[model samples]
Target chain A: MLNFLSTALVPLLASLIVLAGLRRRLDLFACFAEGARQGMGSILSLVPTLVALMVGVEMLSASGLLELLGRALAPAARLLGLPEALMPLVILRPISGNGSLSVLGDLIAKNGADSLVATAGAVILTSTETTLYTAGVYFGSVGARDTGPTIPAALLSDLIAVLVGGGLVKLMLFS
Target chain B: MLNKIWAGMILISTLAGLALGRGAELSGAVFTGCSRALSLAVTLLGVAAFWSGLMHIAEQSGLLAAFAGLLRPLIRLLFPGLGRGGGAEQAIAASMTANIFGLSGAATPLGLRAMAELAKGQPRGMASPHMQMLVLINSASLQIVPATVVALRQEAGSAAPFAIMPAVWLTSAATLVAGVLLLRLLTALARPRRQRASEKGGLRRC
Candidate 1:
């Protein structure tokens, strides 16, 4: 762990810090501030869906829909050779990464940090999150809501990422 | 209007969902389960509706215009070709906000609107620098909340899901840098030829 921190985390941190500094240029900062403000404003537009989405997930879990889904997905995970517990992670990941992470963390704890679940978590970490919703916020801010070209691309990218993460980790480490 | 319709449908569906959940002839425990799922969906849609409406009011009031003014200069400097349409500035702001709050679902509408704005200003046969920049930035966004990650970790019963805060901060920086660097490369390659042909024509006329 110490070696990983030294070799990976530190260097990554250094470069990222440098990039952050560069992004703070007057022009970039302006863009960032503007972007943030618009994002917030647009968020105001979808408050209901936002709230519903969150609560809906919670309700689903409470309703045992997730448990049902979990069981249904178990066979698929087994075929994929993924840890069944991580199915929650896969399902909720698209709706909300934060939600998914909580489940992933639990699985990791139960299955052990060194298990396939843990490694898969790392891979998923490096990929995109909440893509469709995000694409909407940015587009909506401009007052145009059509996601014709972008949605397909973003979803495709996300799907590829999931399989890639799960597959790579399985072949290299789990195998 | 569409939202209202969607809301009604969702509401009815959820209620029906409640019945379906509770209606198990065989499994008595099913009622307990369906009630919880429908209940959650109701709560989430309700809040999202409020926030989304707030944005509409802001839009009608022209707040986006005012906000766009401040970022215009900066946007122009970086995205000189936005030419009035890139609407990149607004889109960037909106996308950032979505990422920050983890409102990915709501973010898309605005992002598309903003991109259309950018496309509107672009000249024929030339891509809008602002639009491209938006794409790059969105691709490598530096998230503030990473709500999904947090939620996932928490759901999984992590002892310290928030521990990824440092990792997120670090990665955003790295990704931002990578994105900007890529944009810089693209810009260098597509810097509009510096008005050379027009300048040469003027010089000859002189």
Candidate 2:
């Protein structure tokens, strides 16, 4: 059920419905081609920015800095009612989506799938956005030089999401 | 902001990698990171192409306008300076709709289009409030389905991956609210004191 919803069903259904509804009046194939071409161009241009940010995140994680940082922030994690196991995940969550995913996978593997820590990690993974990546790619694509308020706003929101995600999991599942 | 963060990441990684005697690993990560990002862009290419193509059909069929109409009230509240019926509004609404359905890959191309639309006629390096808020909102996306999380849980052999629905819903909402509020507050605080500066003629008015 979950597989169907995520991978294929919803998107296919939505596309089919939209196509069916719009068939009579427009040249659908032409529109698709134009849009797809533009899409490709956008993604192509974003590759450099994405690569720069990803390398930053990847090296940060591989250099043991993440571990040191996580250890330092572990006490704050406890203060927020989050398990110590979640410290690295929360810290890495906003910086790198794929990095956090691997960490979440490791967490679930270590602590059973149904464990409170795993559940909270899963929720945090789902709820929080990758702040640095989004800022880099999206703003880079637009050629925006001054990211005046976006980064700080996104970081604060991520902080809130992490805390809220942990708190909710604790209240709902552990109680 | 982005330049600083990128430089900081490089600086920290280099210092830490050398100190920890993992210099080789750090160098390898640079190459691997490039490949990983390339593959990610390739994956997003497919997702973005399909959705953008579909959205083009919707736009040609006038469905895009109808969709933007539905979101106008909220869009207006968030971006009061944006003109109605403009490309930015259509792009933003399409992106938000795609995001709501939990397709970040698809949402991104639409967001890029929206940003481009918003960037038109603006100064080369300056980002308008609308652009700033849009970036923040997109960065802190609120998805209704969160299909990725469910799929991850299912793969991990959880009995019910969808069981985290409540947590997903609550947490996303909180982040969206917090992000928007912070954007509003910070932008207000960060604005230049143009009145005082203008009186002294210290800065030229654009």
Candidate 3:
């Protein structure tokens, strides 16, 4: 399957990407219209979720909840050799990749980027998804809310990514 | 939230132990170390806001659609669940946007916005499950540019920061395929048991 994803899927998908540019299929404009409509509609909701999550995280920081979460998750983080504070970022990364990228930036700087720290940060870049983001936009567009076990499953999957990322980095880059 | 702090404590202690084991004078200096991260976090909050907003604007302006038009069939193949409908086209397009650009942060709000839009008239209870599918797919996300990784390598002063792109591409392939397979397997395994239980319970009896 992995072989297919890389050898077959990626190449085929990338090559077919040229089809989008064929001047005849002006449907590009329509899709943009669709995206714009979707974007405008969600702007209002974005305000609340952003404010709530950002403020909640900030509050967690001030209230020492961040620290507590770190300690509690230390064993788990150690298993991945990640910083406990990284947990929140891990949680947030899948929801907001750029936000986590920004966080990973800070981690790299502090840890002397060339070390395992930077390498692990890089692995995280490849691993995990933005949970809230994907769900919100996809479901809102289609109007489906029955998400089933996607959340739990994705979380578990990302956790595995964290471990794999750390292990790989430790061997290739850090070591 | 307070209870979650234990993880941090453990991490700090482990690092401290490492510091001590290494006999470094700066051992147990996590407080001093994270100071940089705190300051950076403040700066990044704005950066995050800007980038996310930019992605929204891009999506709004049709940049993503242009990209999506290019990859429709392949995406359809990857996300058969999304089908070939208009929404599937858009969803796959948005995903492609996030992946190619490495806008990991921007993808979240956009993803949520995507789901809300997708669920517009889906059968009532179907909303949550479909949204979960979106999340899972996003989590198993693939990347090409890997801006974050490059940034980390540069910060670390790597000899060739972007050299690892090949590895990243390879690993992402592995993870994505594995993740999809795992989810499918789990779902398939759970279906019968769920049916049995649901049969016993039923939705209603007139």
Candidate 4:
């Protein structure tokens, strides 16, 4: 069942059913085309910001800045009772989901399925999001100028999630 | 603020790259990064377009309204600025549902549409409180069923992959609750400051 959903077949199946059901009242193709056009336009407008952010992120990661930051934060992670190795996962969790997902896959492979680190990684991933990416895309789409308090709020939430995830794993599995 | 962050990222990365004596690597990363972003946009174009269309059908079929009705009370509290029974509410509800289901891919278009709606009639540079709430809520997305994590565990040969359900549920719920409370607190704190500014005519622009 999880595998079935993993393929995104569930949403696709549901969309097909919905479209088929609505086709009589609405011109489904026309609606889809209009929506697709709008989506494309937003995507095109967002390319510049996306490229800027992605390049920044890539440089940070490739230049070993993330590793350096992760190393510096290791003690804090340890203080939260999580493994020091999870430092990278915590650091990368909010910036890029793909980066963190790969890190998570590696952690699970290295530490086994039911290990505390892997469990915490899964929980953290579920709890948090790709903050910078989502904010950039969403705000860029809407042309909202002031991120205002959103970034700080999101980062704080990510920090809390990381701590709570590790704490929960420690209490539930370790204790 | 975004400009500063962007500039800071480039500056810091470049300096770090040069300090680490990896100038060649950093220069290469800029091109690779742009290409990666291009591919991402292309990938998102397909998903966003399909979902946007499907969402239109869902909206037309009244399915989205039903979903909105289900989540109305909570959404109403978060978006008091929106008028009653508005389409934006439906879009937001759909996006929130998708987020909960770990369908972030499908949620993007709906989320973007919601922001577009929320920003309507508002000043160009200012994000409404409601918009901030939506972004913060999305940032702390609560996944009830993390299918990807479960699948990853299964692939790793976990005997019972669902065993992590308790931890996932706890973490996500806790984060969401904390996020809402923090947003409330921050907004309350900001209100007085804004009220004072209004007296000085600074609030007229907003």
Name the candidate that leads on TM-score. 2
Candidate 2 residue-pair clash tally = 0
State candidate 2's DockQ: 0.44
- lDDT (10s digit) by residue, model 2, range B15-76: 99999999999998888778766765665667656665665676567664565569778988
lDDT order of candidates, best first? 2, 4, 3, 1
- What tens digits encode model 1's per-residue C-alpha lDDT throughout B1-206? 33553354345445545766643421333343245333433333334333333333333334434544565565566565544643455675665555443455555555566666676744433334465556545654455444444444444455554444444445445545544555566457544554665566633321
Q: Which is the better candidate, 1 or 4, if ranked by DockQ? A: 4
Which DockQ-derived CAPRI band holds candidate 2?
acceptable
Q: Considering just chain B, what TM-score does every model have?
A: 0.52, 0.65, 0.69, 0.64
DockQ of 1: 0.08
Q: Cα deviation in Å at residue A80, candidate 1?
A: 4.5
| Whole-model alpha-carbon lDDT for candidate 3 | 0.56
Ranking by DockQ: 2, 4, 3, 1
TM-score of each: 0.44, 0.69, 0.58, 0.67
The per-candidate count of clashes, in order, stands at 88, 0, 74, 0
Report, to 2 decimal places, the DockQ of model 3.
0.17
- Of all native A–B interface contacts, model 3 reproduces a fraction of 0.24
- Pick by DockQ: 3 or 4, better one: 4
Please identify model 3 stretches exceeding 4 Å from their true place.
A1-106, A130-145, B1-66, B81-85, B103-113, B128-131, B152-159, B203-206
